[model samples]
Structures are given as C-alpha cells and as structure tokens.
Target chain A: MKKLLLAAALSALATGAAWADTVRLGTEGAYPPYNFINDKGEVDGFERELGDEICKRAALDCTWVTNEWDSIIPNLVSSNYDAIIAGMSVTAERDEVIDFTNEYIPPSPSGYVGLAGGSVDVAKGIIAAQINTIQAGHVASSGATLVEFASPDETVAAVKNGEADAVLADKDFLAPIVAESGGMLAFIADDVSIGGGVALGLRESDGELKAKMNTAIDAMKADGTLNTMLVKWFKDAAPQW
Target chain B: MFEICAEPRSLEGLTWLSCYLTTPKHAAMYYSILTVLGLLLAVVPPILFLGFAGALARRSKIAPVRWLGVGYTSIVRGVPDIVFFLFFPIALDQAVEYIRHKIKCADVLEPVYQGNDFVVCQAAKMPLGIADQFYHEAWGFSLAVITFAIVFGAFTANTLHGALNAVPKGQLETARAFGMSERQTFWRVHMPQMWVYALPGLSNLWMILIKATPLLFLLGVKDIVYWAKELGGMKTQVYTYAHPDWRIWYFGALLVFYLFLTWVSQRAFDRIFARASRGLSVAS
Candidate 1:
C-alpha cells in the first residue's frame, strides 16, 4: 500500500508539470512603440508582437502582464512572472539583477521633446527620461537635469506640468508627447538623440530560458518579422539602428 | 608680499556661491515653494472636516446618507491614486469649463466629447481668455490642493468616525441628564475627548500627507522634488560647476529631508499624546 501511494504521488507530479503551459510576461504598458495599452484596453505594439513571436518560436504559451516599472525587477525576483518583455534597456546595474538576451534593438539617438522656449534649449541642457535609458549616460555631462521616471506617461506628464524641461525618450515615443503638448511644448532637433534600443529580460536563474529566447529573436530578425513590426509602429521616423 | 583683498578676483568661490544663492529668480522660487507647502497645509484641514461629515453621514440613521458616505469612501479607496491624480484635475477642469460653456456659449451646438477630443468654446475656458501665467499657476495649485484634500480627507474621516464611536456612552448619558443639548454635549465633552483616541490615527495620516507631497510633481506643481532633480544633474563645461551624474546624491538629500520631517513630526506627536493623557495614569 505504501509503494502504491508513492507511485501515485510521482504520477500526479508528472501530470502537473506536463499540463502547465502558461508563461507570465510583464511589461510597462504605458510606453508606446515598445508596449502600450490601446483605447480598448488591449495591450498592443512592438513588444507584444515580439513577445508573441518569441513564444511561438520557443513553443511556450505566454500571456503578457502589465506591472509598475519600478516593481518589475522585484516582481520577477519574487517569481511574479517568468519573463519581462518591456522595453528595458540593458545596463550594467540592471544586468547585475537579471540576465538579458543578446542585443535585439540596437542603440538609437535619444533627446527631449519640450515646449519652444528660451527656458529650455532641449539641445543644450538637463533632461528627463523613463528610468534606465542610455540617453541618461550621454546627457550626464549636458549639465541638464536628468529626471528619471518609471513610465513614459510620467515622463511626458513632467513635461506637461513644466516640472521637466524636456524628456529623453525614443524619437517615436516623443512624437506623441510633442503632438499632445498642444503647443505648450515641442521637440528639439532629432539629430541630437541618445540611448541604444530596448531588450527582453528574464531572471538570471533562468539561463535555459534565455537561450531559447535568443534563438527565437534570431529567427524573427532573419525572417524580417522584426523589421515589419518596427515599420508598423515607427513609420517614417523609425530608428535605422 | 601676499595681496590682502586688494584686487578682486574674477569669480572667487564665495562670490560665485553668493551670486548663485542671491539671484533674484532663484530667490523667488525658493519662497514660492514655501508658499506652495503653506498652500498645501492650509488647504488640507477643510478636506478633513468634509471627510468627517461624509463618514458620519455614511454612519447616519438615514439610509441615503449612509449609502452616500459608504460610496464615497469605498470608491476612492478602490481606485489607484495614480488614476485619481490623473482623473480629478482634468475632470474638475472640464466640469468647470462645461458650466462656463453653458453660461457663455449657450447658442453653440457642437457636442463636447467629439472622438477622444474635448472641445469647448474658447470663451468658456476656466479663468477666462485673458488670464496671465500666474493665474494658470494658481489655478493648477488650487486643483492639486483640492485633489489632495479629497483623497486624504476620506482617510481622516474614517479615523475620526471610529474615534467618535469609541467615546464612552456613559459620558454622553451624564451630559444629557444634566440638561445639556446634544450639540453642546458633543462640543463640550465628546469632541475634546475624541482627540485622545484619534491622535494615533491622525498622526499616521499626517505622515501619509507628508510623503504624498512628492506626488505634487505629478500634478504639475514644481515642489522640492522637482527642483532637486533639476539642480542635481551633472552640468557640463557650459555651466560654472561641471560634474558627473549626481542624481543619487540629490535623491539621497531628498530622502534625508523626508526622514527629518518624519522624525520631527513623530517627536511633536509624542508630546501632544503626553499632554492629552496628562490627567489619566495607567498602572506604573
């Protein structure tokens, strides 16, 4: 009877492992082009498409989860999600906490979009950006205030509220903020940009999962799926890198 | 022989520091932030009072009053503050404009909500068409204060209502037997005693209010958090004091400032607690 009970427990564990197909993914849904929520409350944009493609390639069924940007890393550490597909930039500090797949989107020029004013020459001074942007590294010497925020919305709101003179964001993301500024703010020259591009990440413990993602990303780039989605979101101003 | 204050140096350390600190515009902003903090402190009290009324109404004998009070507190608590901070200012601004739109542009026939855009007659703009930049700032501050008050007030009301019920029922009965009116008894006996019970909760609410001042940046008021970020970034060759990324230091200073504020408030609350409990002695 004891042998029969032990066998039953092993079989139950195997069945549970076989039936699990869910891959919880997390992202800051407020950022556009990378990831954003549409008016209909559905998550869409480049990151979603990339995540779906990667899941298909890896043969893992996945669902994307919206999480606060500051909490994303901690949540992953706590096993809240198996993966993060947010437009997270790879940096030495963040790399210390999580393992990232190889460079997917390369660096793009980053700068601020603000109102046309003598108070801020977006070309000249301190700036604000979503936390963890490469533009932060470049603008460190610009003598301009570098206000870091968790969401693209907060960065843009900083501009609107006049708390931030300008924002350091992708040229694509800045376009919406500029348009919405309603003449209160405008973008400086786009030639003065900073930041490499975004990346998908996972907890460092998940080394095997990282390898599968790199394979999927390579397939997406090779098959032109990445470029197609890039054009759909970025349009004429898409980063060439 | 050393020169003793004979030739004025182009920009000495003290002179540069003095000029930077004394700049007229900078001075104005220094005082302006204090005004903003004062505005915040001044505006929050009425909200607490309103919240108390709402909580009492929710606990009222009348069903409708109780439902209204319950609905207000629960709905505010349910939604994330980010949503309320985003929604309230815009909603209030639009609501005010709609009223003005009716008054000033009654003949206009275009619908207000037109495909994600809210269009109102130019004449209906709050503060009218000719207001200056300062007017806009004042209006924004007003909106922020109201939003903070409303949100925090609900929490205060919940605290106060609990304190009200905790008052010993025998005290009220004695007051009634002595021919005191209900209103007089509430003011003379119940209200004064409620503070003793309410102090702990009220003190916690004060800390929440203090920590929440940073959210004023979200509302568009340039409080110290905004300035700290602005001043703390590295300046290049163009500026006199060039440096590297110094945001960590700036944020560190802000953390200290907040910590100090909390510490001072905690000390003050302890004194008040002791003073309130002066006559009563617990077993040593």
Candidate 2:
C-alpha cells in the first residue's frame, strides 16, 4: 500500500498534475465508430485508441469506465469520472455544462434514410431519431413529426417496422445498416448539420487537464495519425477537419 | 459449439445455433443472471434479520419503540416497492452529500440545490472527485443494495408480525402455567410455532425479491437486462462476430430463465412448508 502511494506521488510529481492521482476516462461504450465494448468486455473503438494515445502523450496514468450515454455529463459533474471520450459533439447547450477539447473529428452532418419506393419526406414525414442527439434537435424544429428512441440502432429498427417514415443519424452510423439491408433502404434527403464536431468532454474546472488533452489532439491532427485513425474507423467517409 | 463455427458463412442449422449461443457476451449474460441469484442470497438474510427486529419491536411495551416499528411497516407497505427502489439511492446519495456540504463547506456556501442542478462543493462529493474508478462503482452499488434491503425489510416485518399474532394463544398460556418466564416462553414456544405460520408468507416474499432483481439494471449495475441489449444489437462487419439484430431471441431466453427460476422456487417452497409444518395442526 505504501509502495502504491509512492507510485501515485511520483506520477503526480512527474506530471505536476493538480487533479487526481489517476485519470478516469469515461465513455458510453455502446456507440460504434466512436466508442463500444468488444466481445472481450473491454472498451474497443476509435475513441478507445484515441483516448489511450492522448493519455500517453499527456503523461497521465489513465483507466477507463463505461457509462450509459444519457447521464454521461451529469455523472461527470457528480465526479463519477474525470473525462468523457464518448462521441459527444460540442454544442452551445452542452458547452454550458462542460468544456470540450478542440474538435478531434470535424463536423459530420446527419442524413435521413428511409425505405425505397416509400412516401417519406424529410420535411413533412414522421422521423425517427435517437434521443438527445443533434438529429433529434433538428427534427424537433423541421416541421416533421419526430419519434425518439434510446439508441441509434432503435431508430433504424423503427424505420424498418414502419413505425416511422425515416431515421436521422450520422451517415457513418447509418451507412452500414443501409448497405447491410440489401438495397431495402436509401437516403431520403440531404444532410443536416447541427452541432460542432466531436471532442473529449471535460469538467469546466479542469482547465489544465483540458489543455493537456488539446495539445495531444492538436499533435495528432498535425501529424497524419488522426486522419489515419478516422479512415481506419469511419472508412471512406472519414471527415477531414 | 461445433468446430465448424470458425467460418460464419460455412456453418448452418444447429452448428450455427451452438456457435451463436456461446459468444462472450452470451456468456456474460449467463453470469449476469447468476449475479441476480447471488444478490438474493446476499440480501435476503440481512433483510430477514431486520424484519425480525422490527416485528419484535412492534410487540414491545415501550410506546416510542412500538411507534417506530409500526411506522416502518405501515409506510413501506402503503407504497410500491419499486418507488422506494428508484427513489432511495439518489435521495440517499444527495442526503449524504448535503450533510457533508453543510459540515465541510460551512463558511463559503452558496445554495446547493440550484434550479435543475444539485451543486454541492467538490469536497462534499460522495466517493470524492479524485477517488478511484472502482470506488465509484462500489459506492453506487452499496446504495442500491441498501435501498433494496430497506424496502424488503419492511414487508418482511409485516409478514413476521402477522405470523407472531397467528400463533395460538393457548401455547403461551400453557407456558405461563408451567411457571416459565415471559422471555423463555416467547423464545422457546412462540418462536417455533410462529415459523409454521410464517413459512408461506416468507416464501412469497422470496419470489417477489427474485422478480425485483432485474431492477438492478435501473440502479446502474450491469445486470442481465443491460447485457441483453448489448449482445442482442445488430453488429456490423467492424465487430469480430457480426450478426443481425437478435433482441427478440435474447429476451425470449430471459423469459424462459425466469420461468424456470420461479418454478424451482415454487417446488422448493412446497417442500420447506411441508417440513416446517410437520406434526403441527396449523393450516399453512
């Protein structure tokens, strides 16, 4: 125990850190391309790899914790974890509650997808969107009847079940489903951009930790690593910042 | 699982079925079901003990003690258990932090409950902001368990109190005629007779507790319901073992599991009731 305390002290002394003894990286661990748990029950995805790299470059000892997306930010304020590496986009509403590092992945607008030969109109039809998402916010004001689900996949299911005429989500999240559906579905309308790009969420009080993570993110963008990771995860649709 | 499960496309019929059932997430789901059973085993004994104390307290001669016991039983019985289960953990956590806030940051305190937010000082944070990841989970789970215990304990008290009254008055009178002390007669005769009456009610409580285990998911513990959603979602090629949405099948399996569990409990309770009421004239 004394040795463990010494190790913590030495790390704190090395980093000149003012926060905690160890960094806890929180993520939803359910959203794909950004964060998700592998079959091994460990977090594995773009955000997991990116978070590790950031932690390494920042010289911080980090651990990962999985939380549901709905209460992710509130839990952060409650001090359940130090940072959220989940795919949360930076929005003015969210910014009021928490700070974000500079965009890690640039703004990727959402698109509406529906069945082919269907009477769905993005402007007037019943739309399905994941609750608390930018797409949901867009639909709320689009003059379209909106149905919200807990997860992104549920919105797609809603479209398939004829519960809604279309679903609005990140094209990256929807593209695989559209392809896997064997030409049953197609994009109904153009993309709608809402919030700024995804970034690591941090407590507003942790300015020093935020600075450290921003430096790591900026370095990845400067090098080709960030783009490579985007291509590796999001494939051909990888957005260039 | 069949050896042919190595190729997802090559497999067909039962081979595919076997392979699909043995996925890591499926294994985790199985373990999560057992976690509910484990919680019942861990929680039931303490709940029963609390019930016994409350029952005895209700029978106490002292006015305040009897009032405490009566209030506990009545208040909990009057409300739904799930309401308490949902309400207590967050309320208790906030109550703890509020007390700590009052004690620790007594000087420069702003209003803690500000509009929609509960803004306590960093020092007043339960498990603290800097505590380890495991510490946070442990704190949340302990709160859940306490909530479960407090709610079930009240019901158990009510049942045990009823059983105490249902015990034949002649048994106590006989003990008194034999020159036995009040405490001795209550412990030796009344307690044994009370068990025969209590067995049916306690078994019913056990079944309800079994059903309530699934609510652990709502309290933030990664139980069976959480795993069902996680494993049953559609998996794209990005995942190691890609599959279409199979949530219906997963939840169907859970349905069968709960059916079997309740069946086993019913059979076990019948045997226990028969044994407890052996050589007794009670209509249990």
Candidate 3:
C-alpha cells in the first residue's frame, strides 16, 4: 500500500511537468530587417516572423521579448528568456558559451559604410571603427583611440558635425542609415568584412528544446517558408542559410 | 597627413567635390547633433536635483528617512552604474506593466514569470503595445533620462551634502546668534557659501556626466554613437556613394568634436571658478 501511494505521487509530479507548454522568445529589436519593432509597436521583420513560425510548428505558446544587444547573452544565461532569435551571429567563440541551431542564416560579411569624401590612408596603421566593436579590435591591436560614438545616430551625427571622418556598420545596413542620416555619409570601400550571420541561440542545458527548434527550422527551410520570409524582408539582399 | 587647405573649397574647386560634402543625408547629421545636445542639456538638471534629494535624505534627522536615503544612495553606488543603466529602464518598464497588470489583468492565474517569459494581458501592456513609434521612442528616452537622474543624483547628493556640511560651523552659530532661524541660515548664509565649496565637486561631476553620456547607447536610445556605427561600416560599389576605408576618418572627427567640447567646458568652468572665489582671501 505504501509503494502504491508513493508511485501515485511520482506520477502526479511527472504529469504536472509534462503539461507545461509555454515558451519565451528573445530578440534584439535593435537589429532591423531582421527583428525590429514596427511603427505599430509590434515586433516585426524576418526573425520576428520566423520566431512565430517556429512556435507554431512546435505547438508551444510563445511571447516575444526585446533586450539590448550588449546584455542579450548574459540575460539568456540567467534564463531571462527560453530562446533567442536576435540577429545573433553564431561565432565559434560564442558557441563555447551557448548552443545554437544549425545556422538559420548563412555567413554575411559586415563592413563600414561612410560618405564619399576625402580619402584617408589608414592601411599600415589606421583601421576604421568606433572605440568599441570587433572593428575597434582591429584598431586597438594596432594601438589607437578608435573613434567612439554613443549610437548609430551619433556616428552619422559626427560626420554632420564634421567631427568624424567616417562611420562603420554592416554592409547591408548602410542603405537605411544613408537614407535616414540625410546624406551625412555615403559608401566607403567594402574591402574589409566581418563574416557572421544571425542564428537562434539556446542554453546548452535545453537539448530537448534545441532539438525541437532544429527540426522546426529544418522543416521551414524545406517548405520554402524561410526563403519566403527572407524575400519579404531583405528583397534581393536576403542571405541563404 | 595633417595638411590643411588655405580655404575650405566650394563644390567647384575641390576634385573630390562630388565625393565629399554631397550626400543629402550627410548634410542632415549636422542638425541631428543639436538634438543630441538638447537631450543632454535638458535632462541633466533634473537628475542633479534628484541626487540632491537622495543625499539630503541620507543626512536626515528621522531614522526612517535617513535609512531610505542611505538605501537609495548605496543601491545606486553598489552596482556598476552600467548595470543600473541597463536594468532600471527594463525593470521600471516591467514595474509599470505589473501595476497595470494587477488592475487590468487581475485574472491572470499563472505567475508573471513562467520559466523565462513575462506575460501580461493585453490590457496591462505599457504604452498599450499599439502606441506610435514616436511615443515608444519618447517613452524609452524618458526612461533613460530617469535612470540617468536616479544614478547620478546619488553622486550629486554626496557632493552637495559634503558642501552643505563644509560651511564653517562658526557661520551657522553666528547666524543663530543674530536671531536668524535655521531655515533662513540655510538659505542665505549656508546656501550661498555652499556653491563656492561645491563648485569643484560639481564641476568634477559634470565631467563624469560628459563621459557617462556615451552609455546612452546601452539604453536603446538612438543617440550619436548609434549613428557613428551605422555610417562607419563598409559599403560596396552598388551603393549610391562609394569610397574606400573611411571609418578612421569618421572616428577622428568624433575625437575632435569631443576634444573641442571638453576644451570649451574647461574654459567656462575656469571663469565660473574665478567668480565663485572672488570674495575669499584665504591662504592656500
């Protein structure tokens, strides 16, 4: 009688755990054309749609949450969210800290886009970038102040203020900045590029959930949903997975 | 590399005229910095006042008031201000929602944090999930400004408190002997003298504030740093305006701008300092 009662209690606990179906999704709304808040104040863009599809495919109720680009990783580790669909590149270094889905998006090169103006000869010593960034690493390795700004707006603002010689950004993101910045900048050379593409991030402990996501993503790619979403957002610039 | 032209050439004389100073967007970023300046200038004073309150509370006579003040000041100081800067806006955002959540989503049976997500009913959404882009930006900016004030206010309080105390004890005693009330002494005798002592500390705080302005990026506010990173990246030949390797130039421009601002501020502070010290004859 005691053994039977103990088994009954264990079964109840397992049933309670199995009934949970909610999932939390994270994104860096800062990255546009991937995931950004629309004028409607709703999360929109390719990653946003893709995240929704994944939840639909997995049959889990999901909610979208936005976080800053810098703190997204730390927040993920703390279980601030269950999954991250931000335009996070799956770098080898980052892989050591968190497991990722098979590259949801393939490698895309990032480079600085500046207004056309006076040529700067920074080949031997000078590399273009703000005081912080992977690009800044290029300058710091060579030992320099590495120009710094507070935001994308300020970076372009520097050119308008005649305070900065150029600005750095992803090659794909330049068009919008150029359009919005009121001609303060134009295209610089695309010689130097940073190779990485956004991927879905998951905590390593959630192997079960990660496997589920991978399957859903694979199905999306197979069914042409991924391509369709990319074209809707990126037009011709949408990268292949 | 450092050579200069005798006259800043017009579009006619310069060889790279089309390449330089020609993009329509480039012309607009100039005015944008004014907006950035406006944000900094408009937001800082209120923060100072807030800091003053926090500091004064810590020095209060009532134990509870003193404890509250101590808590505010210490909480602001203990964590890295960056963490506070990032966390406060989101936490405050959630707090606003949570309050709304209780009123609008009173029926939510499950906990707010289920595993990792914070879910509130539609009625409880802060800014109502359907607000305009401008409203969201404004809300975000206001939150950033408040965070700035809360964090910096504590430091300002510490400075102001010390300044308030540094007024010689004899001055307070003399005021009392003259039959002036404590309030009157604080306003006339102490308040007036406190600035002279506070000037040095306040000026230092101001410099720190200037340095701290860059962290606005972390707050999700679209400040100048955001634009720099946006415009400084490399672009291909397909782009409207094409050049080669210009991020160093963009960043160099920023360095000069900050240096100029700092230099001008130093000059202004010097004038204020001299005026504040005018009536004193104490030996160094």
List residue ranges in candidate 1 displaced over 4 A: A1-241, B1-12, B23-29, B238-241, B278-284
Tell me how far the alpha carbon of residue B28 in candidate 3 is from the true structure, in angstroms, after superposition. Answer: 7.0
Residues B160-259, candidate 1: write the lDDT tens digits: 8888888788888999999999889989887777778888998998888888887776655657776555445433222333334466776797788779
lDDT of each: 0.68, 0.82, 0.65
lDDT of 2 by residue, B198-269 (tens): 888888888988888878866677788788888888877767667888889888988888889889999998
| Candidate with the greatest DockQ versus the true structure | 2
Residues A98-165 of candidate 3: C-alpha lDDT, one tens digit per residue: 77886677776665555567565444323345333455555555453357653343455555555655
Every model's TM-score on chain B:
0.85, 0.85, 0.84
Model 1: lDDT equals: 0.68
Model 3, span B1-284: residue lDDT tens: 01232222322345444334434344434544664676668667887788678767977899999898888877787889888886788788888778767865688786666444565655555444443345555776788778877877888888888888888888889999999997998887877777777878888877777767767767656566554544454433323333444667777877787778778888888888787667755312
**For residues A82-119, what per-residue lDDT tens digits would candidate 2 score against the true structure?**
79888888999998888889999899978889997787
DockQ-based class of model 3: incorrect
DockQ of each: 0.02, 0.27, 0.05
Q: Cα deviation in Å at residue B182, candidate 2?
A: 2.1
> By summed lDDT, which 10 consecutive residues of candidate 2 chain B come out lowest?
B108-117
- For every model shown, the clashing-pair count is 12, 0, 53
User: Whose lDDT is higher: candidate 1's or candidate 3's?
Assistant: 1
Off by over 4 Å in 3: A1-69, A72-241, B1-32, B282-284
